[model samples]
Structures are given as structure tokens and as C-alpha cells.
Target: MKITDDMIDYISELARLRLKDEEKESARNEMEKIINYMDTLNQLDTTGIEAMSHAFPMKNVFRKDEVRPSADRDDILLNAPDKKNGAFKVPKTFE
Candidate 1:
């Protein structure tokens, strides 16, 4: 999975990147290191380990939903910069 200079060039072209020779070399080395690390991880043994979505045990901790009294309409509308007939108003932009 080592990234070659040609591969780096192709990726740069696809991404529309303009890279100097030094940058291309740097990218190639970094990509190679990432592939090597993945190769190292693949060598680990986990024969009976169960796959899990979460690292720790978890349960829903949400509070029960309940309807509550709301503020008066006029009080809430007071914060609006522009209002019309108890509704927020905005400038019309198009026909």
C-alpha cells in the first residue's frame, strides 16, 4: 500500500492541487507511513473478542417528555426586530 510518486501526482491532479517537488515527496512519505501502521494493526490477534459499537456500556438517560405552559405571544414577539399581526416579518426579496 505504499504510495508512489506517480500515485501522489494522480491524487494531486484529482484534487486540483498544485504541489512543489518537496510537497509531493512529503505526501508520498506520509501516505506510506499510514499504510504501514495499518499493516501493523492487521497483525494483531483477537480471535474471540466481540465487536462493539461503543467502548463502554451505555443506556438511554433522557428525562420523560412533558408538555408545559408557554410564554404569552406578545411577550415573545417583543424580541423580534419586525413584526406584523403577531408574526415575525421579513423583507420580500423576489417576486
Candidate 2:
């Protein structure tokens, strides 16, 4: 696809970019090159190849969950410098 100056102007406006006269020409050239590369890729034959989100295979690595006893609240709070009503007291994060 041909990248025109009008196309560049429309794209810059949508992107909230302020391109100078010289920069507009540079952008047009770079955008044309990118489009040409994508067009070239469209010519490749891969009828049976499966599409993938990533280049490598992916799988969850989590271990099996198991029930376990938890630490006592009193024993866990022994190291806290300040606490309130059986809970750690921290500085207010929001007004």
C-alpha cells in the first residue's frame, strides 16, 4: 500500500503527535518501508502451519495444592513494633 502525506497527517493527528515538515517526510518513508515488509510476508505459503501467540510452547508450572496448618496469630505478631486489635498497625496509605 502506498503511504501518502494525507495518510501520515491523519495518523499523526490520531496519535497526538506534532511532526515538523521534514519529520513528516521521514515518517512517511519509514511507514512505507514497514508496509512493504508486511506485504512481502503476505506472499509466504503456510497453509498447514498453526498460528501461535508466542514462538515457544507454554504451560502452567504450578505444583499441586495441599492443606496445611497456619502459624498462630499471637506468635506471628510477636515481632511487630505496633499492632491493633490482633492485627498489624501500619500508617494510613490514603486520606
Q: Which candidate number would show the highest TM-score if scored against the true structure?
A: 2
Deviation of model 1 at 42, angstroms: 3.2
Cα lDDT of model 2 by residue, 1-95, tens digit: 89999999999999999899999999999999998888987789989998998788888689769988799999999999999999999999899
Candidate 1 local lDDT, 19-82, one digit each (tens): 9999888889998998788888678898898989888998879986898879999999999999
Clash statistics: count for each candidate? 0, 0
What are the lDDT figures for the candidates, one per model?
0.88, 0.93
Specify the highest-lDDT model's number: 2
Clashing pairs in 1: none
Write down the TM-score of every candidate: 0.40, 0.47
- Model 2 reaches what TM-score against the true structure? 0.47
